[model samples]
Target: MALDDIRARIRAAEAAAGRPPGSVTLIAVSKLQPADRVEAALDQGQRVFGENYVQEAQRKWPAWRARWPEVALHMIGPLQSNKARAAVELFDAIHGVDRASLARRLARVAQETGLAPQVFVQVNTGAEPQKAGVLPAEADALIQECRQLGLNLAGCMCIPPDDADPRPHFQLLRETATRNGLSGLSMGMSADFETAIAEGATHVRVGSAIFGARPTERPG
Candidate 1:
């Protein structure tokens, strides 16, 4: 019922934004949710999923890939360079390529695997030093560098300052993607997704709104 409600809300948001029906991608953040829960959502016709940890996803998704080939997994948390090969081979796209080093590793992995999952350069739009995204000032160069490395750079992603109006950050990410000729905007989350859609988000990473809450709670 919650997933249905969230999908209804997503459709409403998309329509209100003047986007075509189903223009937005809803990534059920299945980070701490168990495999059974994910399979239930799949039964309900939800296919796109997001995972925060590589190790956890690796443990869960391989079986599903054979059974539900249409399901897509997105890496929506900070990615480690050491896990580049696993990330490339496991995910359909990653929303957390935040630096040149990580991008380079992914590129190398792609060269070896003959596959490059789609990628989005995370931007620290709020300029928070502790975050994983590239600073807004550095986003362009980083995106360019990632693209040049032959990675399938899809667009841009951002996490707005928590408890603040996320519209500005959403707008910034939208603008950055437009300037770089990128098409995807992986912005917004459980709380601000509607505003994200209004600001041109093509993908929103929603967790609690659909899956209840994280088993180990953290600030969104």
Candidate 2:
């Protein structure tokens, strides 16, 4: 029932945006959530799931893969260069390839692993000093550089400022992708995903809407 509700909202958002239902990909963000919950979503025919931590995903992916080999996995959190090898080995697509150094490392790791992982260049649309993305002004050049590094530059991703209207950020990303000839935009999450879909979000990372509030992590 919960999955259906989420699906209905997705459909309505697509219709409201004048986009076909098939246009958007719903990336169920299962970060901090257990595999059983993911299996439930899978039972509803959802194939793409996004994970944050490399270690967490490493623990989850193999079991899930054994059960559902065709499922697509996306790395949707801040990725450190240290985790590049594991991330390249685990995720099918990575949504947070923000830095040029990280992109180079990921490309090298992918080359060694013989896995051409799809990637999104994250842009700090809000220019938040603490965020893990290239500043908005520098995004295009960085993306071009990533392309030159032999990384599969799929598109862009962004996290809007908490107090601002996310629509403008979404609009800017969509416009940038269009102007730059990029086709993927992995923007939007549970709170403002409807607005994102309205503004041309090719991929929406929704976690709580599907899996309930994320569980608090236990300190090891």
Q: For model 2, which pairs clash?
A: none
* Model 2 residue 8 CA deviation in Å: 1.2
Local distance difference test values of all predictions, in order: 0.91, 0.87
Candidate 1 lDDT score at position 158: 98
Q: Which ten residues in a row have the lowest lDDT in candidate 1?
A: 211-220
Model 2 scores a TM of 0.95
- Please, what's the RMSD in Å of model 1? 2.2
Encode model 2's per-residue lDDT on 1-220: one tens digit a residue. Answer: 2778877898999999898978889899888886678888988898999988888888777987888899999999999999999988888899898888898898899789899889998988989898888888888888888888898788999989999999999988888788789989888888998999988899999989889976788312
Off by over 4 Å in 1: 217-220
